[model samples]
Target: MVTVPTRVRLGYAVGSFCTANFTTIPGLLLLIYMTNVLAVDPLLAGVVVFLPKAWDLVANTLVGQWSDRTVSRWGPRRPWLLGGAAILPIAFVVMFIGPPLTGVPAALFVGAAFLVAASGYALYEVPYKAMPAEMTHDYHERTSLLQWRMIFIAIGIGMSGILAPILAGDTVEGYRLMGLVFGVILLLAMLASFFGTANAPYTGQAEPEASLKAQLRAARTSKPFMWLLGLSSAQTLGAYVMLAGAPYFAAYTVGSTGATTTLFAALVGPMLVTMPLWVWLAKKLDKRGAMILSGVLFMTGAVAAVATPLFGPLYAHLVIVVVGVGYAGLQLLQFSMLADVIAYDGMVSGKRRGGVFTGLWTAVESAVAAFGATIYGATLAIGGFRESDPANPVTQPQSAEFAVLIGITVVPAAIILLGVLMTFKYDLTSAKMSQVSHDVT
Candidate 1:
């Protein structure tokens, strides 16, 4: 058994704090910012949200391929990691500054900022995801490693998920403060990983396939990769949609905007605390099977959460605990399973293009999440959510409340079901993983 040093694992997991912060801001808060601060139409805001991830899709693949072929002393992935870390915070602050301009001019600034921020994160995240396959061959070890990684991911989600809104308050000034403080947090986390993981052994590409076309071809031919690509993207889309619904659910359904952070704490805190239990479940059931079980659990929880309003005023938070448990399972297992698929690719293809695979994985994930914003914003627009004014607060209508409920409940439940079905095609059981790892080593 190859043991990954505890520091290396800790370093790698800390990087996820930055990734989670980047993901949380846009997923949870960005579109709302468009409606409230910029006075952009909800439909237009959705369009703005979806369009920039197009750039993110392109960047993930290009950078993934770039990392695979490059030869450097600092290592192909590390140099880009450090470079991206420095540039990302600048764009992070820009997204929240919500320039003094209004109408189309304001919309354009936020859109442009998202493009830059998403692009910067691609450089860091694709390489970061790729590193795990190279780090170890043990199947359960990958799960354990990723379990810690997901714990930090939850920590990021918890801190930023709840804190960003509190810090930003319901004002433009609060958001500006949020941008500066959280931007620093993001910069520090990424840099910590870059320096802290200095002792990690770098895996060089052994095969000669270097072109982007070649890399894409490699990913396309791998059946397991294709299966995981769809499954992971679907579940992530569901997760983001559910998160986007939280503020609305709090505002319209639960009747308190201040309940937003409490809802987030309910979701993330329980998920974080229960991660070790999910890890144990994955060890018992194997990653793919564990993910299937998590999907079912999440689907049921999401559906059940919809009815929490009938129970009482504050009952929604308690209902969210169920969703959080299932979410915890999915978060912990899916990434470990991806690591398995990457290992399988290295073995069957006789090449270790972990960077390209992870890149494409994240790229498609960005593209799918684009639709999550589209779904959230377009649905709210359909429900007649009045965009907030700079001078006055906004009240949501029945249409808005209805849209949020479905997005949180029915939509996520369905998306997760598809992800569970895709798992039937994901064939890496524990016994098989042993063979896959041996083939690579």
Candidate 2:
């Protein structure tokens, strides 16, 4: 039996505080800040959102490849964690502070700040995500371990998602303070994870690392890897957009600041409550099936969201709970499945390149999120959503309301439906993964 200490797991899971805070909350708030706070053109702001992602696509892979070859007393991944702990928080803070510029200049400043923040985040996340495959070779144990991590992810999302908007309510200064407070929390969480996993045995990360090119080649050859990447990237387009656009959806469709909170809770509450059910389902149905099931649930909720104007916001939230239930399954299985893919790769490829693969994973995640924000921003720009002014709230055009509807509904539903079809062809199964785990361990 491959068992890990609960202490180590908690320590590692704590890192999700930083990851969730950085990914979820900012993803929700940033584009709005650009359009509303600085009065940037929505389409141009989307371009700013996209620039850092382009960098991460290249940067995360390089960082992951470098970390794999690192030789240090603390081991390969841990040292990067500490560096990330320092850099990401500082970068995060900079991204939110309003520099005394507007239009293209303001866009340029935010784009630069976000690029640095994304780079620091990738440094921490890629190696952290890769750690699961190295720490446990047990097929089910990895799932168990990741369930705990998902719990931390939930906590971070709930706390950050609620706090950020409340703290930054209708003002630039408020956002700055929100950034500072969350920056401190993020720093603390990263340190806990770095120190917490001090005693974890490094099983999969053997020395004599492969060249970056060879590692890339192996990841390319893994069908399971490619499938997960495509499925996740496609679905995340909807997921990130829903998260990023929820405020707009609530404000325009539901007509209350509180509605955004309700939306957040509807998603997070069910996700927290039903995670165990999803984990168990993964055990019974396998990751691929679970993901497809999740996709269906997500599509159903998104389609329901399209009719927000007809149903009261209360009913919309009820439907969101359904989406949340499915999101839990997708969230857990995708992560656990990736760990399985890496383990499988280690078995057949004769090398451990977990960092490189995970780096690529973060790269894809970053890209999709960036694309989500940009696509939504462009759509809103087309729909005539007014640039935000905290001093005097701009009345959005009728088309902008429909744009939020599309971002939260139509575009995402189509993409998720496509991703669900892709899952049908995914060949990795629990039985195959179990054999891989047994052979390796």
Candidate 3:
């Protein structure tokens, strides 16, 4: 087995940190900022956030394909990494500064800036994701490497969420301060990864020249990959739906704005703390088994969340913690499984096409997530929610309970169930992954 250096692993972790900061900020707070601070209609604010992410569907794949073909002295991935690192902060700052003018100008500014940020994210993220398959050919080592990266990702996400509120001081300041702080953090992490991993050898094997269409066609034909894509996209949509509605749930359902922090913490904190345990479970059960187990846990917790009116917030939080544990497993295993699929594709096609696979994976994921957010935002509007009134009671129009229940439970449960059903199509196992690694090496 080829061994990689500690710095290479560290660089990988830090690189993910930079890219994830953008996701964490908007993921946790953008909705609140739009509705409460900028005073965009809540449903409209949701659309503002939702529209930009849709760009990722096209942009991420194109970026990945372009990176795969490009040759650079720094290698295929690092140049884009450096460029993205430099520009991401500026895009981030623009995204959260809110529109300078009201009406169309404001909406246009938010949408345009968000699209720019998503592009920057694609540049950095697709290359960064493609790195692991090239970095090590060892099956177990890849798992270990991904575990460390996920840990850093969890930390970056947690820190972004925890600190954004503190720095914001209020909704207006929160968006501005979060933009600045996370922007700086992203810059630093990007630089660290770029410089630190610069000398790390490009261990990736070469592929026969193929058109982008051929590469995409090859990816489409991979059954295991398609299964993973379906499962992860569905599961991710559920998670984003729940996350997108969380702030509203805390404020309205629970009758406390402060509950937003508590709810965020409750959801994210356990996953961070239990990451190691999940890693152990993955090792013991294998990625597919772990993922299946995660689906079961999440489904149970989601059902319990729907029962929150009967059980109260305390019980709901406890059940959600159980769900968080499952989420942690899913997060770690899903990417590791993706890596396995990349290796599988290489072994079958006699090509190193990690960039194409990762790019497509990311693109599909972005599209599904964007669609999920759109549905969520539209649902809130249908439920008769008005962003204008912060003090509106949960029982208003007596329809909000249904909205909260659907957002927190029914939607996610259906998505998770679909993901579980799709898993039967995944033929790749740990043994298969091991064979692919052996053949590649």
C-alpha lDDT values of all predictions: 0.82, 0.84, 0.74
lDDT of 1 by residue, 1-441 (tens): 566889998998999988789888788888777788778888888888888887777899888888877677767677778878977899989887865876678788989988898889898999888888777767788888888899899999998779998997767898899999999999999999998788886443456365788878988988878888888888998888887777777777777878889988988877778988888888888787788888888888788777866885567877687778888898888788888888777777777677788888888888677768888888888888888756977666777788878777888888888888988888778888787667656
Worst 10 residues of 2 by lDDT: 201-210
Those runs of model 3 whose alpha carbons end farther than 4 Å from true positions after fitting are 100-105, 389-396, 437-441
Candidates ranked, most accurate by lDDT first: 2, 1, 3
Which pairs of residues collide in model 2? Answer: 36-388
Error of 3 at 20 (Å): 2.8
What is the alpha-carbon lDDT for the whole of candidate 3?
A: 0.74
Candidate 3 lands at a TM-score of 0.92
TM-score for all models, in order of appearance: 0.96, 0.97, 0.92
- List, residue by residue over 1-441, the lDDT tens digit for candidate 2: 568899988988999898889888667888888888787888898888878987888889988898888778988889999888879999888877857666688889889988888888988998999888888877788889999898888888888778788888767788889889898998999999999999876667555346888888878888999988898888888788788788888888888876776688888887788888888787788778788999999999988888878878888988899888878878788888888888788777667688899999999898888888888888887888888566666787788888888888888789889989999988888788767757766
The best candidate in terms of TM-score: 2
Candidate whose lDDT is highest: 2
